[model samples]
Structures are given as structure tokens and as C-alpha cells.
Target: MFLVESKGGAIACMLFSLLFLGTWPAVLAFLERRGRLPQHTYLDYSITNLLAAVIIALTLGQMGDDKPGMPNFITQLYQDNWPSVLFAMVGGVVLSIGNLSTQYAWALVGLSVVEVVSASITVVIGTTLNYFLDDKINKAYILFPGVACFLIAVILGSLVHSSNASDNKKKLSHLSSGYEDKVVYISLLFLSWNKGASKDPENGKEVKVPAQFGTAEYLIELEDKRSIKVFDRSIWLGLAITFFSGICFSLFSPAFNLATNDQFHLLKKGVPHLVVYTAFFYFSVCCFVVAIVLNITFLYHPILNLPKSSIKAYIADSKGRGWALLAGLLCGFGNGLQFMGGQAAGYAAADAVQALPLVSTFWAVLLFGEYRKSSRRTYILLVSMLLMFVVAVAFLERRGRLPQHTYLDYSITNLLAAVIIALTLGQMGDAKPGMPNFLTQLHQDNWPCVLFAMVGGVVLSIGNLSTQYAWALVGLSVVEVVGSSITVVIGTTLNYFLDDKINKADNLFPGVACFLIAVILGSLVHSSNASDNKKKLSYLSSGFEDKAGKIAFDSNKGASVDPEKGRQTKEVAQFGTAEYLIELENKRSIKVLDKGIWLGLTITFFSGICFSMFSPAFNLATNDQFHLLQKGIPHLMVYTAFFYFSACCFVVAIVLNIIFLYYPILNLPKSSFKAYLADSEGRGWALLAGFLCGFGNGLQFMGGQAAGYAAADAVQALPLVSTFWAILLFGEYRKSSRRTYVLLVSMLLMFIVAVGILMASSGHRK
Candidate 1:
């Protein structure tokens, strides 16, 4: 059987599983919203769900040469492993029930809320159990912290839902009272035939109804289009079911863990532990059995006063059969991948994927428009909840304990260390023994230079913002290379002239030529990678088109294709290999698809220009090359200039980010200042990032003042760090064509050579 031995491979599996699992719920929800019977949908889903397991058994389960300890899937089928098999079956049963409960809960609670709550509960209970079962492979400090984050996210999610519901209630009340005086007309149309009207009678004439939130009219429209009758249900009922589902979900993973590992020594001595494939196959079979029995029972005797259905009715219902089938395939494969990953990594770490609410919230916003026009408080809670989930997942993904104390503790310790070093090791000799420090000097003179420093900060802020978008558009490696190269070539040249050409001209000019060459190679790399991605997208589109044709044929014979069906078809086409790219685009606050590559390049160029100016501006602030200040005024020290620079940078960044929250460019969703203030997640990390940037910039300026400023531009080699992370963490260049890889390597090499040459030209300032 195939095995994922490497940590990276296991991580890849878990991430893919997370995407697939998160997506299937949205599919099922969509079908339900389109009025497809849950009974029929589940039955259709069950068939493909079992089929997916069988497909895995035949393919990955039997691929490698069989060994004694780890038998192939088919061989294990005949072995005497009923004890482990029972455990697997039990896990399947629990998972099936959890899925069934969620179908109803989704209608009562919002999709995002339900997902967050259930996932949080699952992580809290299931991850702990799995940690013990896996012999505590996961670090308790990191794992528990992640679990705590999820718990906080759960509370925030609940508050967000409560606030949003209150908003809807108020909207409906106002809407009802506003139209109370209008001439009323209630038409008794056939419930099955009429699609419902969006008009209100006024003065014996039909008037178009305004957009609604939660009026009786809106409820009726929802009831007409939904399979489950949830208009009269209380939110309490949903929460109760959600809790139950979470409990069930929490147990299933542990049961599966026992089945595969036999960690408790439940089976007899001779019976080998069940492999992942055998366990997964049995698990799926039992899950399919449970789903079939329950859904068939529900068909004959419906709940929530839903119309009764029969086996015959279910067979005849083809309205959303394709989607239901697709959801099953997604869920089945998702579960298999999760199990495979759990077997390689500890199941406790694999539980990180329970942060699926992050993905669900993306779909909820993009597809269902769940939080559109929500209250400021609701938006704030929603963003905070998502941020907490992200942090929690990051913590879970870490493989080991932190080296020292907590991040905050280490940061504080470092600060104290720096202060001690500065007081002792950084003392000046007798020549400047009585001189005041830079901070005191700031108040005495060179106040006008602070303006230049603040201007530098403004330019840096703009460049930083632009680079963020550029990273998403052009890959990180290219963006870093091009942006850094621009800074070195332009900013370094300006600094050399500003410093009265103290640096060696021959070496500096050669370094500038190297940077220009690196820039060209960076552009070429981006173009090649873009072409590769386009080809991949084209292949996915072609395959999906064929599937769409079959769907159209089925629709023609079974049911008339409506606009909703058309939209679903279009969305489904974006699934498969390109799903990650599509999901990333949807999840981002900024929307940039219409302009694509050119827009990214434009932003990068603009950022490069901004970046190119900041250094020169700072140089002028410290050296007073333009003599803008009075002759008697002392030139600003590095520390004084940096203090003004960072202060202005902070102000500009806050103002712009806040503005973007409300009046965002690139078609981003609207936000408010309240939401900005409400975001508690990652705030500490954000402060840390700002602190590091300020400290680093101050040090760079200090070094440049002693040596030639042009040599200090070598810090622009930051692309080296960024590229390493882009490849290792984000998987930026995976599966790219040979040509793209070649250009990428060439660009990096040229950039390194250029940085080294620039540093070699360093000259001592008099």
C-alpha cells in the first residue's frame, strides 16, 4: 500500500483534506437551498461516498508490493481483524450521524456559525483524545494553546451570530412597520405552482417590493426554496443539534485512531493492526449503510413537517443529483485524505483542519452572501472569529515546542538584552564623553529634518501596502526580486551622489548592472510561471466543460435549467485542480481577477518607485545634502530621524488601513472602524512586526551613516528570506515548468551576486 512517510507529504494531505471537507458542506447546503429533498440528496450522496472508498481501495490501497506487517488492502479484507473492523464501523456510524445532524442545524444556525462551533468543539474534545491515543506525539504547549484559540473563536462566532440575528430582526420590524399603511393585497396562489411574488399591492396597483431581511414575506420565499422547513424552528434547537453533532464528530476520530493503531491492545496478539486503507474502506461501508438506513427512514416519515417522500420519489428526483453526488465524492475523498494524513502525522496535529470554518466562511460570503450589509458589531465579531481560527490552525501546524519561553517573553527578554548591550558596549570614547544622546539632541536641533523623515515614512508605507498585493498577483519570489532590485538600483545610485560619491564607482556601477539584469530575469520568471498556471487552468476547464455537457443533458430530460442551476454549474466548473486558486481568490478581501497580471506588475512597479525614494529621503534627512535646514542647525542623528520616520509610518498605515476598511479599492467587501477595533486576533503579532521593522530600519540607517549609504542598500537582499519562506511555507514554485524554474534560479543568483558586489564597494565616511 502507498504511505506518506515525510512530514511535508502528510501536511500536504491534511491541507487538501481541509479544502475538500470544507467545500462539500457548501455543496449540500446549496442543493438544500434549491429545494432538493434532503432524503434524496443523502441517498445519492451515499452511493458515491461508498464508491469513493472502493476507488481508493483499488488504486492507492493496492499499488505497492505487499509486505508482512503492512498487507495490501485486498489481503486485509480476508484477515481476522473483526475487533479493529468493529471500531472502524463504529467511527463511520458516528460520523454519519454527525453529518445528518448538521444538515438540519445549518438551516437554523448560519453556516459559518454552526461550522465554527462544531469545529471548535471537535478540536477541544477530539484533539485531546487523539493526542493521548497517539502517545502524545503532539506538543502539549502548542496543541493546548491552539485548542484555547479555537475556544475563543467559538465564543466570538456565537456573538457574531447573535448580533447579526438581532440586526435582521430590527430590519424586518422596520420594514413591516414602514409598509403597514399601504393598501394590502394577499393572493392565495397554489403553493407548488407559484414561485412567489416580489411585489406588494399599493392603491390597487402592483408595486415592486424592496429588499427584505426577515419579514414574513421573506420567510415564505425561503420556505418555498428550501427542502427543510426551518421557518418556525428556534435557534436553540439548532444549537442543541450542533452540540450533539460536535460530540459525535469528536468521538469518530478517536475511534478510527484505535482501529488503525490498536493503541489500547484491544485486538488479540496475532491479529495485525488494520492499515489505513482497510480501515477507511470498512469505515465508509458502515457510514454508507447508516446514511442509507436513516435517509430511507426519513423518506417514509419526514421530520420538521417536511413532505413525506418514498424510494420511488427519491429515484425520480434528479433536480440536484449531480451536485449531491459530487458532494459525496468530495466528502469521501476528504475523509480518506484526513485518515491518511493522521496516520503519518499524529491525529492530534491533523485536527488542525477542524478550522474548516475559515473555508466555510469564505463560501458563505462569496456564494450565499451571508453577512452582506451586516451590522458593524456583527462584522467585527465575524472578522475576529476568523482571525482566531487562523492563529489556532497555525499553532497546531507547528511540529515542536518553542525553543525558549513564549513569543512575548522572548521579545521582552531581547529588548532588555539590547538595552544592556547599548549601555555598556556602545559607550563613546572621551571625544564625545559629555555629548547628549540622539533622543536629547532631537529636542535641541534638526527639527526641520523630521519632515524629511516623515515623508520617507509615508513613501515606505505606500510601498509596503503595494507589495502585499503584488505578492498575491506576481509570486512572492518575483515580487521580492523586482522590488528589491529597484530599491538597490535607484535608491543606491541616489545615495551615492547624496553622500558626495564616497563609494567606489566601478564596483557600484557593476552591481547596479547586475541588479538590472536580475530585474529582467525576475520578469521572465513571472511570465513563465503565469503561462504554466494558465495551462493548468485550461486543462481543468476543458474537463469541467465535458462534465457540464453531461449535466446539461441530464437537466434537459429531468428538470428545466434555471438561473440558479446555471450559476451552480459555473461554480462547479471552478472545482478540481484549480480549486485552491479559486478559493484563495474568494478568501482575499481584495478582488483583482479582472486585471490579472498587468495589474500586479503595475502595483509592483509603483511599489518599487516608492521603495526607491524612501532611502534617499532618509539619507537627506540625516546628511542635509540639500541644506534645507538653517546652517547653524545640527544634522539629525539616525535614532532621531528613525523615531520620526516610524511614528509617521504608523500613523499613515493606520489611517490607510482604516480607510480601506470602509472605502476599499479593488472591489473588496466593505468594513468599518468598529470591526478594525474589534479584531483581537493577531494584534500582538502585528505590534511585534511593527516593532521589528522600526528597530531594523534604525540599525540600517546607523550603519549607512558610518559607512557609505550605497553599501547599506545590501539589506535589499531581503528577497533571500522571502523566497525561502515562499517556497517552504506557501509552495510557490511547485510543479512549475522547467523554463520557469530556470528563470527563477537565474534571478536569485543574479540578485545575490549584485548584493555582494554592492557590499564590496563599501567606503568609510570621513
Candidate 2:
């Protein structure tokens, strides 16, 4: 009978299997992403997978077996039976075909459908094949039931995936709707129908409408407008391919098993080789050869999605190459672990690895924004699937003598480790003799300013969010220049009006003008320097591929085209490839910013106004109207204000993050418990930054309490502090030309002039 041999072996197999199952999703996702990018094609997938197989083989070949006296992999493989090697080669060929088919299917059907089909079928087929291939088993009942349960789990997980994908699509649709006004929406739909002949909604009859018509026609068009959803043929074909791809994938393990099975004597006797390593070597060789041959054929009849120059262009992208390389490494490691587990245990153990749909499902829901707005039914199904996997894995790996360990055990341990590390680091940092620690400061009775600061913090956070959204829609340089100017002017105006202690022209206008001028000049210099860099890069680079496989120039910023749309552009290619590439990149960048320019600018202006009120709000609360609570020690007001501000920032950040997790109105990243734990590792640095910011806020408020809001804020016009630090400490401007240097220096000079003007314009105390 086939046995686990020992508890250690079973545990090792389980760990390796999980590793194998978990990694495939990540690796494949990376490959698919690279292939789908503007310049990449299916050939990238072929190359990376081949490379991964080769790397795995070589690495595995170098390692000795568990037995001390066993020969190294090179000797073992060389001595292994030829038929065994042949079986492995067949397995590799099957694997290559299945993987290619799966990729094609993914492109055709969406990610949701493809993942579900392949995963469910592969789990069932692979497990069945492996079980039948090997007769040895200590507990057949436990194994079979476990496989069945795991299959159910896979199906349930697919349902969850489908539900999540549907939700995300709906969310995206809502976002698009939000972007369009009623007029724009009606106009776009009118134009769309007119682009091609469509049936009239009123009579269900064919009609050809003109693009620009009279008001009566526009009214008629709006009345006839109804929702129409067109289904693509490719989606059905993709589903079909994906279904068969799973079956093909299932054959790979059985073939490998036949090659490596010593107990069954499927191969020639007396072959003294490590089964996993030897099989991998042969499989890798076959995979490498097959991928090259297929890729060559693909060159003549390229895939539907890929551009003609995709092969060359993909190779030119350095960032893409890095992703490809990392993916290959991960895939290799994962595959190797799977084989090791299968060889050590049995097909049942390997099949149990299919329980990885649980991991994939978890990540999809938690990280990839799956099921955020899914129905209660979706969650129930997902939980049920998880339970099934739990029961399956538990039964499959159960041995009466062994201690049962769950994922919770590992999670708790990891969490404890993180907490302990954070506390230890915090204690060590607290040992430094400079400032009062965060806890001590927080606990001290500084209530009034604290309340004021907290309220101000919320306003600042909202403004920051608006500014971020503005940046994405508007160009960076404009937002920075305009936002800074608005902040200075509005803050100064508010202070002057509210305090009634400042002269309008002398205290606010001239200072605002100087600050605005400085901001404008500084922004211009920065943008110009960046433009110059782009120019230099365009001129010098001959469009050769770099070591990382990216084109030497910035394709996103300059002249790169979406290969699919511009595939036939021999004219552009004839032009210096460098010029053509830079042009394409420039067009892409322009299109993105231009689309939402107006809305983004409007939001940015509002954000700037909101940001300006922050200091004034605190000033009013601590020193003016709400100063009844400030009767105690003056230092307490500053400290109390800071405490409240910090508390507000913390609370606001947490609440907003939680809200985004479900609705994602801003489409921001969702915060999760896992992420929180991960952030704990860097808690020491985070705490330090927070402490510095709080101390700075307290001091700023203290200055305001003494000097009035106008003067306190005017001093902040010293952008030169940041500029000097960036230059002197980080050597940021070392590569800039003399002209760039002059502009930067001039900007700094203006900042100094503005700060001096504003500080001099400080209002008198009431």
C-alpha cells in the first residue's frame, strides 16, 4: 500500500502542494498581463514559460535527494530509462499545448469564466487520473471523499468569482455614467447609433439616421433610445477552448506519474534517479523545443489580439521583461514543488493541491476587489466553498498520530510575530532622548487645540483626496501651480476678513501675488526641465531594447502607439523608429489628460480652497471665538490642538479606507486585515513620520497663537526648505543642465521673496 512514509513527509508534501497551487495563479496572471499590454504578444508567454521550465530543471538537477547516498540529479537522469524520459517529454508537450489554449481562451472569454472552467475541470480530471494511475493507498475512502469535496469547493469558488466580476463591471459602468452629463450622454448615444444603421425602437424597423439633424429629430432619437447589449462570438469560442484545455492539463500529471512511478514499474526497472528532478529535466527540454517551434509558426499567422511588431516591441520593454522574468521564476518554483509533493505522496496529495482555488478566491475578494458589491448569496456560496476545501484538505491529509494544524494557527503566529516586532521597535525608538513619545503626548490633557486640530485634519484629508483625483484627470504641473496659488490667496483672504485686523492690499494682495508668481515660475521650471529631459532622451536613444527589454525611451510619455490600432503604420516605422516611438507615447499621454481636463481642474480649485481654510479653522478655535477652553496653560492649547488633529486624521483615514473597500467611489485600494498586519512590519518608520508631523503641527499652531494666522501661514511659503533639502541631502538636481539650475534657483529666490512679503504683511492682533 502507498503511504505518507512519515508525518514530516506528509507535512512537507502539503506545504509544497499549497505553494505550487498558490503560485500558478500569480505567474499566469503576470504572463497574461504582459501579453495583453500594448507591445506584448502570446510569444512572450511562450518564451517565459519555456525559460521557467528550463530554470526549474537546472535548479532541481543540482540538488541531491533526501537519501544521503543517492546520486546527484545529473547522474540520475543520465542513468534513467529512456521510456521514462519519453513519458516526461510527452507530459511537457501536453502541458505546453494546454497552457497556450488556456491563454487563448482567457483572451476570448473574460477572466472570470476562463478561471472557473479550467480550475474546476483540472481539479476533477487531474485527481481522477492520478488516483487511477497508482493503485497504492493507505486510506482510499478518505482520499476519494476528499477529492469529491475539493471538486465541490472548486465549483463554489467559481460562482464567487463570477459574482465578483459582475459586480466590478457594474461599478465601472456606474463610474462611466457618473463621468457623463445628461447632455453628453444623450449626444454620445445619438452619435453612436448614427455611426451605423440601427433598428428603430418604436417600430423595431431598420433605420439610417444622419449624424447632425434638427431638434425634432433629436427629440425622436431620445424617445427611441433603448439599451442594447451586443454579445461577441469570441466569448463562446473561448469558453469551449478553456473547457478542453482543462482536460489537456489533466493528462500532464498522469504522464509525469507514468514516467516517475517506481511502485507501478511503469518505466524500465533499475533506474536510480530522483523521479521529480529527472522528470522535470526531460519535461523542460520538450517544453523549450515545442515553444520555439510554435512561436515561429505564430510569426507567420499572428494571434488575433497581438500586433505584427509585438514580438520586437515586447522584447524592447524593460519593465515587462522584469515581470516576465519574475513570473517565470515563481512558476518554476511552484511547478517543482508540485512535482516533489506528487512524487513523495501520491496523486491524491497532488490533487488535494487543487484546493488552491480557496487561496485564489480569497485574494480575488480581498485584494483584487472581487465581490465588493456582491449579493449575500455570493458570500454564502463563497463561505460554503471555503468550508468544503477545509474539510477536504483536513480529511485528505489526516493521520491519527499527527497533530492537526490549521491556517488560523499560522495566521495567529504571523500576527503575534508582527505585533511583538512592532512593540520592540517602538520601545527601542522611545529610548532616544529627544522628544516626548507619541503615547505620552496623546495622554496629556491638551483638549481644546486637540479638538480644533482634529476638525481641521478631516477637512485637510478630504482636500487631499480631491487633489489626488484632480491629479489623475488633470496634468500634474497645472494642478500643482494652480492649487498652490489658490491655497495662498484664499487662506490670506479668509484670515484678513475674519480677523478684521489686517489691511487688504498690504497684508494679503501683494503677498498673494508674489506667492502666486513664485509658484507659477517654479512649476514652469520643473515642467520645462522634464520636457527637456524627454527631448534629450528622444534625440540620443536609437530605439534599441534595453537589458530589461524595455525600449530606451519612455513610451508612455512620448511616441508609442497601441500596437493593435497602429499595426499597419509602415509610414511611422519608416520614419526614424525613435521619432515614431516618441510620438506614439506623446499621443497616449495627451489623450488621457485631455479627456477629463475640465472636471479635474474644477475639483482641484475646490480642493485648494478647502486646504486654505485648515489653518484658519484651528486659529479660530484656539485663539479667537472658541478660546473659552484655552484659559489654562497656553502650551496646553497647542498640544491639545495637535492631539485632536492627529486623532482626526487617523479616524478620517480609517473611515474613508473602510468605505472605499465596499463602494470604492474613488476606486482607491481597499484596506484589509492582511494589509494592516503587513503594515505593522514598517510601524516603526510610520510612527516616526507621524511623530514628526504632529510635532510640526503643534509648533505651527503655537506660532499661529502668538503671531496670528496670516503670518504663521506666510512663513510656510518657504518651499526653499524642501528644495534645499532635496538638493543638498538627496542630490536631486545633479543631472540638470545649467538652464534648469538657473530656473530652480530663480524659483527658490521667488519663494524667498514671497515669504518675506507675506511675513511683512502680517495683520495686527485684535
All candidates: CA RMSD (Å): 27.8, 29.6
CA lDDT for candidate 2: 0.54
Q: State model 1's lDDT.
A: 0.75
lDDT of 2 by residue, 82-193 (tens): 7778888998898777766765654444344455556557766777777777775536666667667757865675665556445434433432453223354445555656
For candidate 1, write residues 1-766 as lDDT tens digits: 8987765567557766877898898988888878988889888988999999999989999998988789999999998998899999999999999999988878777789889889988998999999999999888877998888888987887787778767655644543443222212122113312444344545564443533544445544555568775634556777888888889999999999999999878777777799999999999999999999999999999987789999999888999999999999999999999999899888998787786676677667656667777789988998788877776776643211111111222233224323432343233333143344554555665767788988998999788778767877797889999998998889999999998999988999999999999989988888887777666556445543343433333332323346755533323222223444444444444433344677788888889989999999898988888887775566776666766776677667666766666676665556665654444333333333343455566668878989978989999988997797577545687777899999999999999999999999999888
Clashes of each: 0, 27
Quote each prediction's TM-score: 0.53, 0.44
Alpha-carbon local distance difference test for all models: 0.75, 0.54
Best by TM-score: 1
Predicted candidate 2, C-alpha RMSD = 29.6
